[model samples]
Target: MNDRRIPGPLRRRPAAASLAAVALVALAATACSGKAEEEGGGGGGADGVATDIGVSDSTITLGALTDMTGPYATLGASVTQAQQLWADQTNDAGGICGRDVELVVRDHGYDAEQAVSAYSETSSQVLAYSQFIGSAYVNTVRERIDGQDQVLVLPQAWSADLLGSEYIQMVGSTYDLETINAIDFLAEEFGLGEGDTLGHVYFEGAYGENALAGSRHAAEELGLSVAEQRIAPTDEDMTAQVRALAGDGVDAIVVSAGPRQAASVAGVAAAAGLEVPIIGNNSAFAPQLLDTGAGPALLANYYVASPALPIGAEEGTPAELSAAYAEAYPDDQLDNGVAAGYSAISLLGQALEAACEAEDLTREGVAQAMLAMTEADNGFGIAHDFSDPAAPSSTESYILRPDADTPGGLTVLGDPFTSPLTDSYTRE
Candidate 1:
């Protein structure tokens, strides 16, 4: 791994073994917070590290506001479990700064009200949020997360609207950038240029809108017309949308919704004889879709754009994580969520260790430590730079296609690339 330390203030600290022992002995249980045991102790412990909320003498509590029993329930469960696996590994390795890392997880069920309530319930107890899923839901709590609590959050969803916040750190490329790269790939592969129309099927929210923004930008740059079809997250059937796009004589289609929506669109398009190359954002496809009736259609024409390598890949971090996850979760299947979730916590852990070395484990200190990381690479196929808050960590995206025989049901179709148009485009 790259040396994540960024020349912060340093001091001689206690041994990891000794610190773990001390923290274990000094650790006490908290009653109100579901998973947060520490209520933020002031002053230094046996070690002279500065502490604040969510950090007791012995433990550092982090939060995960996730979706369960909702649209992304499968991904949510896998991501939460991956985070738990990282926590276990960190604690087993003697913890960070002699403190055991504790994760406080809550399922929001992808409901707006429930998401806010979950955050309100656990905001005071966590030093930062390791996993905050859902783009629109996270937008609702942006003010509180950055202004009121001043906590660093690594959200699972990537929306351009979430950019330019010191407290909210996105790990990979945003939806707009990913979409731009996807459009570039499609144009390269299918000779789509001036006068051609590209169909966009997206959800009616931040995630979908941001991706739509990318498609629009690409359309302008390539002189292609855009056929827009906006649908709600609850709208899974794509028969109408696909028929409309086909009637418009679109050269291609971009699906920025869920895996179910992607499947429906591909199936409906094939059945309708649309016969166009279909593109999707990272979150649009799941491995399980291969077993459905739409599987052949998806494999025949569909391609996906992603900021990270698929968990099914046989090299780098994905390979190692796949083996460990398979061992840790024998009953569960592998997915991209596992890699994404592990990467988020791993990046946060990097910041925590940097803060500990700087002798400032407070929220502000940790935030600064993360900001100091100009080149953050966790072996996730992208070398992310967190220096610019307004820009995405990385603009490069992997172009992948679904395969029934692949380990994670997706295979790398080509080398990762970034669109030149992305440089001229501005993020809001």
Candidate 2:
């Protein structure tokens, strides 16, 4: 892992060290607002009331628990910037329901313990968590979030455990559903036939397991064979795994890991003369990989299944939004994380707006509003419907292939694709 932190304006304060000062400042500001709004009292509708800790007549604070100094630091930095952009835009538009959206960001370094500590310190001071960056961190805090009635927007959609959670909402299709869609694309686009063998390289956690589950199901339905390899998030080399899969004569590889791991797999496979196609889940692909030795390898054989369009697709909501973001922050590189951050805030904004309109701005109110959302315009050429708790938030994914000319080193291959497995997959 890189020891250097994210540079420039993107770096954020460590969660544990900065929580006290941030809370004190927020409280002081709130105190002044309370004095002014005392006469007006709560600001909600006739039937709904705003008695939440983070809610005030003029402001609503949101917490962001992110990994600014860990394996995902680059992504975290992009997400934070996108989130700030969303808040700034909303505030410029007169804010959400007349209350300015104030996002308090914290760096948890992708550690579960750090995340818990950050949550403990900041949970009471915010209306809801605008972003929680890791599946493990979320799992660690799941019980507490439920027990305390906290509402949050999860950064990843790979965990089946998050299904139907009252406090946690996701913005994309689950890892399982995404893998199924990827399989469908491969089968159709590449002329994969019965008895074709597919290799899967994945992290050894919920995200990977869920993706594997989806691949397994799809393989069964499609009459394909699966060869599986489990890698840890911290694993640096995937040479052995790739070699074994290649030795097994797998026709293609499906990766459910991160950028580094993805790069390793592609590089090693190329080095070992395995030229089969490699497909990855959303998180497995990153623009940074293009700068590595694996760049050519990836361009030659890599594809990614994304819940949203690529960052700089020529046409779509994502393209327009990315253009606006570039105009706003020219220094930042447009990537999937930035789009993801924007999507999260967009969804949260919808819920907040709905809650405000209903005169219920409490955490529960926000959750209810989110669940009631029938159609969420992702502003990125994707559609998400959260009305059905049993269904994945998104059941479709766009396939992307590497492109040197694109900002994210990728371009959408075709229209968003869906599979029947997604509709029938049971959420656990």
Candidate 3:
């Protein structure tokens, strides 16, 4: 194994182009419509699909379809916390364009039907959907956002469909790319042989499927074959899944689940007796998973992605973000989901900021602001430019490995690698 996990500052960053903040212009869009009505939504969804109805006054109301309970609770919690931190920071710093932000949280319990109801019920009131989970659920309500010309989306799942169209802006690597990122790092940085079979254990849902699709693509590209296993989210007994994987002599396993579901599958996979490495989705980096009584099963051979810096995990990235969020929310967990939420809000803040600058606070205007944003610093990773209508996406994904040794608990590998821009996403 020729593991090489060092900083590669040699890679040039994408030019600081303008990002599209059409949401900010949303206020202007409604304003320009003359007889425009707030209609209750804050923003649109997928390809500028109107998931959120409209916004009135300077205060923007954002609707969210979050997972407070069920499979993704842990990750959902982090997503919520991140958004909360952003709101607090923005509010404290005098909010978007001198206007206060009104955020509404609705629990989806990781259910698609519940998600649709939550979005439908709240869409009429907020301007856009924030921190909503799953592509399955997002697709359910995509048209509503489009019909109203609203922008409703954030940086969550790595679904590939978001890469095209103007309705949605997904801010991470695509399914194929994110999955490839982990394998790429495992092989290039961790120094593993291409002949090894990459074991995959995932839920039978879109979240897991998207990853599976991506991993399969990458594996083929990397000259690797995959040993696949699917398990129910609620099934506690993973003896079947793990044993099947072990029987196949799997080399490495990448499991995707929120927390509870992840713990169930990870525990099974670890105890499956192969002693292979067990990797997980970015959401699996929570302390909950490590402390799930799956000790050795996870201790050394287990790793996951720290999408955002863990509370105070590493320096430069983690510490800085931690401090900012801590100051924003003096009392909170500041765990995994919060970090993601914080980043999402920061992006939204930038969108709003640009919208204010463009004098386009209407739905279309804010969408314009979100999409036309040239360049602005929101204190996160890279300076995103959403000016390109043809290819509306940003590729900024950080790689992290959290182990027992690090005092802060997580170790960041290197600078975030840019997902192929052409294959990136557009925030709806």
Candidate 4:
């Protein structure tokens, strides 16, 4: 649920209509907001480091800016709720290292200009900056804020681009790992091994191109072949693309597209009797993406490359997050982004807890706490030991064939593609 009471200093804006609304990747942060928190009493540093959560003289303010009310409103709301829940819980627990957690959220409506404005407005006002940002937006902000030493937990994933940057360190698996993980699942489980042609469909832009690049690298490493095609974001009908791919010798299908586009592809594929199993990125789970509301037609014969824990899975600490959010938000029907957002929070919360106890809660203290961690028991064990952001992925992806065997989708296979934690891109 969106906190209605935004600080008056932050401004809101109506955004221009846009496309490329998709799912994203995660964390890397630093800062001590609440000038008071910066100058507050320090807690005991058992290991010579201050925790991400520490006691401030008055309050520990956490600054955030998100695309909460625009094209990507669904995911934005979830991230907003989950983040606030983290603050609420931390506050309830007597605060991080003793300071009461204060969360401040700003809406950017998916606009770069507005995002930077919000960033500038909320800058230095909190202990750290954590928010959901898209690829282009991140690209826009990265260069501008490159010189700041404050930690900014990225709530979205962008593969190796942000992970490798000296200025940013992410907390989740990259799209490169995500795509390969999906392919690995298809190959091993169904026996679509070497010599198999993995058919793919993607949006005709950077999002798709990057995902395709990952697939190419993974396919080569696995000795698999691929046949690719492109779809314009403006096209609502994918019958032509489906017929074309099925007509070719394409085997399995992977979709690197958003909600509306991917749904069209799935619909067309099913209509044409294109039984080749369909695969998609996490973007497929967006609000208008999956035709979950269209009943079985929208639900059957497809799988998604998940970036976070599945919705149907067990409810651990992450599930009981900010009560206000869980009680106020209405995304249970579209919980993919919600789960991903919460999982991202879970990772950050743990890191923050560790950081708060450190001798220094500065940028270096937080980064060291994050990198030093190898065994993070975050709820479902989906991202265990994801300590190195430079490596991009600490865990792989699982298959959610919800439309395949079960009505609500079943995990027919688990961790199909465990990505490498090393620093090299594979070439066939």
Best-matching candidate per TM-score: 1
lDDT of each: 0.82, 0.76, 0.60, 0.58
Supply the TM-score for candidate 1.
0.90
Tens-digit lDDT string for candidate 1 (1-428): 11221222111111111122222222221122323324454566578898878887779999999987888887888899999999998999999999899999999898776776788788778888999988777767665566656888898988888777888888888898889889988878898999999999999878998899899999999999999999998998999998889889999999999889999999999988889999999888888888899999999999989888888888788888888898999998787788889988998999999999999998888998989898887878888877777766777888989988876788887666777777667654
Model 3 C-alpha lDDT per residue in residues 1-428, reported as the tens digit of each score: 12233222112122111113322333333333322244443453332323224454456777677887877776786678667666776778887655678788888897756665666566556555567777666655555455653554663665554444454666544554456567766776555457878888776656677678767766776678898877766665666877777777777778765555545556776555566666677765566456557654566666665444555455444567677766765764456665566666677667766666765555566666667665543444545555553332444456665555543345665666643321322222
Q: How accurate is candidate 1 locally (lDDT)?
A: 0.82
Tell me the spans in candidate 4 whose CA falls farther than 4 Å from its real position. Answer: 1-56, 204-206, 221-225, 231-240, 286-294, 315-334, 403-412, 415-428
RMSD each, Å = 9.4, 9.5, 8.0, 10.1
- Candidate 2 residue runs with Cα over 4 Å from true position: 1-49, 423-428
Q: Write the per-residue lDDT of candidate 4 for residues 1-428, one digit (tens) a residue.
A: 11121111111121111223311111112232234334434553454444333224546566667766764566677667766766776678787655676777888886656665566555555456566466555654453345553444554644445554433545555666668767766765567777878888886654576678778877787777878888765566777777888888777888887656667777777777776777888766553334453235456667777755555554554344423454755444435555666666656666667876665565446656666668676664455554554554354565675543321233434533454411245411
Ranking by TM-score: 1, 2, 3, 4
TM-score, model 2 to reference? 0.86
Give the poorly placed runs of model 1, Cα more than 4 Å off.
1-39
- Can you give the lDDT of residue 145 in candidate 2? 66
State in Å the error of residue 221, model 3: 2.2
Candidate 4 lDDT at 205 equals: 53
In model 1, what are the clashing residue pairs, if there are any?
none
